[model samples]
Target: MTAEQINDKIELCESAMDLILSEGSFTIAQLSEATGKTASQIYSLFPNKKAITEYYYPSLVIRYSAMIGEIEDFESYTISEKLSNFIFTTFDMMEDRREFVEDTFEKMVFKKGCNSEFHQEMTALFKHFFTTDGRIAVSAGFVMKDYFYEFIAREYLDIVKFWLNDDSDGKERSFALTDKLTGFVEEVVYNKVIDKGFDLAKYLISHAGLAKNIPLFGEWITSWFNDNEEENKDE
Candidate 1:
C-alpha cells in the first residue's frame, strides 16, 4: 500500500481501538463517527473490525519506521541502539492503547499469529541498520539465512508477553530487560555466535552420523557451514 493509504488505515485502526475501549464494541458507523470520516471512507481502509485489529501491531511497526525515519541521526545508531529504539518506541506506542492490546491479545496473537508478519517486517526494517549481516549475505553468505529472523520475531513476541505482565513503575524492569537482551544479542549474533553454533552443530551431527538420516535440515546446516568457511578463505 502507498504510505498515504497506510496512514489512513492506521488512523481508522486507532479510532476502532478507542471505540472498542470506551464503548466495549466496534462498528463501522461508530468508527466513522469517531474518525470523523464517512462509513464508506472507513470501509475503504478497514472492511471490518477484525481487519482493524489485525493491522494494529503491524501498524505499530510502520509507526516506528516512520518515527525513526524522521530522526536525522537514526541511521547512525549502533545495532543495539537501533534495536532499543525499535522496541522502546513500540512500547511507547502501545502504552496509550494498552487496554486495547490486553483485550485483544489472545485474538491477535493466539488467533491470527501476528509474529509471522510483524517481526519479519521489523527485520526488514532492521535490515536498513543491521548492515553487517546484509553485507555478509551479499559477499560471504546469508548470515541470517533462513529462520534466523523468524526466530528473532518469536523472541520479540516472547519479550512483548513479558512486558505486558510487567507491573513495575513505568515498566522500568521491562525496559531494562529489552536493553540487556538486545545488548547481549547484538554482541553475540554480530560477533560470529551463529558460526560458532554451526561448528558445534557440525561436530555433533558428524559424531551422531545424522548425515544418513536427516537430509533437509542437516544439509542446510552443512551448506551454511561450508559457505561461511569458503567466505573465510576468501577473506
Candidate 2:
C-alpha cells in the first residue's frame, strides 16, 4: 500500500477509536458520521467495528516502541527499571482508553484466531527488553530463547489485564505485583530452580505410574535410584 493510503487508514482507525473512547461503544455509522465519511467507505477500510479496535493494537505497539525509543537514559537502566517503565508507560497511554481496550480484549477471547495476533504483539513488546546493539542480550552462560520470550510476553499480558481491573490509588498494587513477579522470575532463573524443579518433576512423574508404559520411564527410575545410592554412599 502507498504511504498515503496507509496514512488514510490510520486516520480512519483513529477516528473510530475516538468514537469508541467517547461512547464506550461505536458502530460504523457513528464512525462514518464522526469522520465525515460514507458508511461504505468505512466498511471498505474496516470490515467491522471490532476490526478498527484490532487495528489499534498494532498502532499502539508502534507508538509504544517509539515512545520508549526516545527515552534518554533507557540503556543505562537496569532490567527491572526498564520493565517497570514499560509497564507504567503502557498504563499511562491506555489510561484514557482502558474501556475500549477491555472491550476489545473481551471480543478477542470469543473470536477464534484473534488471540494469536494479540500474543504476537505482546511477544514483540517483551522482546524490547534484553536487546543490546539491536540484538537479543545474552549472559555469560545463558540465552533468552524463544520459549523464554513467549513466557515473559504471556506473563506481561496477564499482569496488564490484572492492572486494568486493579482498584488502587495510582495503580500501586499493580506496580508492586509486577515488581514481585519480575523478581520472582529472576530469582528462579538465577538460582537454577527451573532446572532442578524440572528434574524433580520428572522423578515424581516417573514414580506416579502414569509413565509406566513410556520407554524412558525405566531409565529415569534407574537414574533416580542410582543418584540416591550415590548420595547415600557419600554420606
Candidate 3:
C-alpha cells in the first residue's frame, strides 16, 4: 500500500483504540460513531474486528522503519545495536499507550489472534533487517535467511509478551533482556562465524574418525568425508 493509505489505516486504528479504551472493545456501530462513517463505510474500511488487529503491527513496523530511516548512520550500526534500538524504540512508542497496547495485544496477538497476512508482513520486514544492503552477510545468506526471519518474528512476539507483563520500574528488565538476547544473536549471525564453526566441527569429527559414534549424523558425516576425498583426488 502507498504511504497515504498506510497512514489512513493507522489513523483508523488510533481511533479504534480510543473507543476501546473508553468503552471496551469495538463494535461496528461504535466505530461508525467514532469515525463519522456509516456501518457500510466502516465495513469497507475494516471487514471485521480482526482487520483492525491485523493493521496494528504493520503500522508499528512501518513507523519503526521510518524512524530508522531518519538515522543518518543506521547503516553503520551493528545487528545488536539495530535490534537494541528497535526494542527500545518500540517500547518508547508503547509507553504512553501501554493500556491501549495491552488491550489490543492480548485480544489480537497474545491470544493467537494473528493471521497469515500478519505473519507474512513480519517475515518480510525481518528479512529486510537481516539481509538488507551489507547488514548481515551470513555464509549461506539466502539459504538461511528464512530461518533467521522466523527467529526474529518469534523473538519479537516473545519480547512483546514480556513487556506486557513486566512490572519493573520503567520496564528496565525488559530492556536488559533485549540487550543480552540481541548480543548473543549477533555473535552467531555475524559474517561467516557460524559457517566456520560448522566447518571446524565437521573436520574434527572426520579427523578423529568419530562419525561412526555420532549416531544421527554418523553416516552422513562418513559420506561427507568420502565426497571431499574424491573432490581432492579429482584436483
Which one is best on lDDT? 1
Candidate 2: which stretches are off by over 4 Å?
1-10, 27-45, 109-114, 133-143, 184-235
How does residue 87 of candidate 3 score in lDDT? 75
Cα lDDT computed for each candidate against the true fold: 0.72, 0.66, 0.71
Candidate 3 pairs with clashing backbones = none
lDDT of 1: 0.72
- Residue 153's C-alpha lDDT in candidate 1? 61
**Cα-lDDT of candidate 3:** 0.71
What would the TM-score be for candidate 3 when compared with the true structure? 0.72
Q: Provide TM-scores for the models.
A: 0.73, 0.63, 0.72
Error of 2 at 51 (Å): 1.1
Q: Per-residue CA lDDT of candidate 1, range 1-235, in tens?
A: 7888888998988877788778888888777777788877777886677888778888888888778758887666776787888888888888898898776666676444434456567667765556544323232135554455555666677778889999999899998988898897677555655556776657856787664366687677767767877977986
Residue pairs that clash (backbone atoms under 3 angstroms), model 2: none
- Residues 28-64, candidate 2: write the lDDT tens digits: 7787777788888777777777677777756655567
